[model samples]
Target: MYSIHRSFADNCMAVTAPVRSKGRFTIGCDIIEADKLSNRLVALLPKTLDLRAANAVRLGLRELLINAVEHGCLEVGFELKSKIAESDDYLQFLLERQKLPEYRLRTVQVEYEIRPQRIVFRITDGGKGFDHKHRTHKAREDDALAHLAHGRGIKMSLRIFDRVRYNTAGNSVTVLKKLA
Candidate 1:
């Protein structure tokens, strides 16, 4: 589903907080920031969860980070995103957006903790938020929108995490997963 999305975050260093503790980091609107951060955070996670579960978390985490960068930081709406996803130069288009003054300085903030019983993540973006309540939650294989590139991230996050809570302003999201 995210085949074209792979190159956006290749071979970049992540800005991260300390390991094995609660930490916070911020990233720019550009694409590399999302993938790098997710890989770094997953490396810092405890090893108790089975490999399958860990992989799920990794995939979901990356998706959420991408969502924040695309929708929140870069202000790319669903309709425009749908159009962009079908194009060959999706990453180039996103990079072009980052060059714009309005989006150049926008950022996404991530706060997280590695706890014994659960993991908590708070992802906040600087752009004006939307009505998150109106966003889709289901990503069924039969769903046409879910088959698209842009809409699956939030659905993946909601499916993999125990809880996903978005702020009233929709700029921030907090996700929790029990470790048992």
Candidate 2:
């Protein structure tokens, strides 16, 4: 396959956010970019008045954002990622994947709307989604601190968001945090 020939930073520069009464942020899978987007989104929510609640939302948002990037856009499998994490090639693998034509252009999108009672976030990725029917909301609380990398974010997200729903395709997830 051919390469896209752009640096991750270059791709991140293309992320576009147009703020208003509602907000949307289109982003690449880079962690720095994801964290930044999470922070920006949380800042827009007045419902997170308590510091602890704000932090929880921030953490969950970041986790799901990374999930969309790695599992969805980058196409890194759970077992394969675990295999790489125990070695030194994981970073190299991600870098290589990010240059490939199929993966390089894929992106994760985060759209948010503030309703009278809650804030909703929809994070969608450009990849073939896995089967998610078997995934449970409480699947990995015990594994949250384990050496495994893939399951904790989703678990944390379930705890933080008031509601979490996944599309049948599994590439898109929607989360809500209540205001009152």
Candidate 3:
């Protein structure tokens, strides 16, 4: 038997009881301020996954969560991020944005569920959502677009997750990967 604990702001905590051999299970959920995410958060996942899958989850979740923090919460759009990437001012911009009251107060909510066949995650960010349909549908893998940097995260998410679906407003995303 094992349990997973998730800590949120204000010292709040959520704990998942020992998982059973049931068909599906709702593990736990957590809320973290957009600016507060870190690599250490990866430890929040259960040890149920093997090394390779765990690494994939860490990388995929980090990218998507950072997208939520940077794009969804901080309102850094594609064009601006592209320019920042070229100028190598992204770190500075992130620092400045972290101080903004509006962006500072926003949060990202994450929910996790374990099922007999897969693991599901629902991640939502505080921001005016975008056109998820257009973004996901029109994303092309041609050489021209592949050479760009901004869309790589989304492209990577598409390939990594068994399924990746975004809300109509695009502020929320649900991803799942098979567990075996």
List of clashing residue pairs for candidate 2: none
Write one digit per residue (lDDT tens) for candidate 3, span 132-178.
77667655454435878667667767877899999888999999888
- lDDT for model 2 comes to 0.75
Best by TM-score: 1
Q: Which segments of model 3 are wrong by more than 4 Å?
A: 1-48, 140-144
Cα lDDT tens digits for candidate 2, 1-180: 123223322332343433324867898766668878887776676632455676688889989888788889998888888889788787787877778888888888998897657778999999898766555534544664455556777778878988989998999999998877
Instruction: Please report, in order, the local distance difference test score of every candidate based on alpha carbons.
Output: 0.78, 0.75, 0.65
| Count of steric clashes across candidates, in order | 0, 0, 0
Instruction: List candidate 2 segments past 4 Å from native.
Output: 1-20, 137-149
Model 3 error, position 18 (Å): 4.6
Could you give me the TM-score of model 2 versus the true structure? Answer: 0.80
* Pairs that collide, model 1: none
